[model samples]
Target: MKKFLIIAVMALSLGAYAQVDPTFEKEGDKVKATYFHANGEKSQEGYFLNEKLEGEWKMFNEKGEKIAMGNYENGVRTGTWLFWEGDVKSEVSFDNNRIASVSKAGKKDPVVSNK
Candidate 1:
């Protein structure tokens, strides 16, 4: 039963990932995209084509401010991901076609725990 449950979960996850837009266009190329999220208000919206993200995508905050932007390949975060608060830019970094390094601006601030 446990093994069956694991397979079921994997299948469902893969299904959603495979559920991409079949009619999406990319100017000259025959790219596609699937809306992983709805309304594009909260959470985050994802686009996929050729089973990869081939255009500019945005992930906004609850206040409707863009927090991340840039190119995306497949399901992994690749290229530059610029973070901002409305017009107040925050952090930005480059990704090596895979989610790895994440560099912030300047010095790292100290953390305070309220134990």
Candidate 2:
């Protein structure tokens, strides 16, 4: 009986670590996917083409605050991406999925162009 009780407890505990599946919706040639946090808040959202990541994607914290925004093409990161943390904001540019340039600015600072 004790062994059965321990096994049951372990099985229930494993369920807590399980990942929630993302929801997908069809949109023309692309599919929009919205992934969720364990708490049911939106974690990230984006579009996929031919099962590969495509177009703009946005990520958010558990509280639903946008933390990062970027674009992907053919499953590869492309174009400019922005990240926000507290009062600071970072801009990153990509070329062929490689970092091309990066710049940062603060709430009280001037907007710096990517270098």
Candidate 3:
């Protein structure tokens, strides 16, 4: 019974991964890609250049709410990114795909851009 349960769990995991397929469309020199959750809601949308992540990317939660937005250059994260959680928002700056700094603000607080 333990082995059977393990197999069943593995099968379900594979099914979940399969459901998160991304759709791509050509956009001039870049390709716009949108990845969906298992429930068919958009999980993230962004652009690709030469099969690498490029340009702006926006991430959404399961409820289709925007959770994060950022930019990438040559598959590496660049510039500032915004992440929302409840009544708080975080601004993170990246340098060479590493977090350079981060600041949090309340809903009524003014957010300063690092970029």
How accurate locally, in lDDT, is each candidate?
0.58, 0.94, 0.93
Better of 1 and 3 by TM-score: 3
After the best TM-score superposition of candidate 2, give how far the Cα of residue 25 lies from its true spot, in angstroms. 0.4
Across residues 11-78, which tens digit of lDDT does each residue of candidate 1 receive?
98877655333235454453544243333344345556666565667766656556777776555566
Candidate 1 vs 2: which has more TM-score: 2
| Model 1 lDDT at residue 49 | 63
Q: Give stretches of model 1 more than 4 Å off.
A: 1-46, 74-76, 85-88, 98-115
Which residue pairs of candidate 3 clash? none
TM value for model 1: 0.41
For model 3, the stretches where C-alpha displacement exceeds 4 angstroms are 1-20, 109-115
For model 2, where is the 10-residue window of minimal lDDT? 106-115
lDDT of model 3, residue 11: 97
CA RMSD, predictions in order = 10.0, 6.3, 7.1
Model 2 misplacement above 4 A: 1-18, 109-115
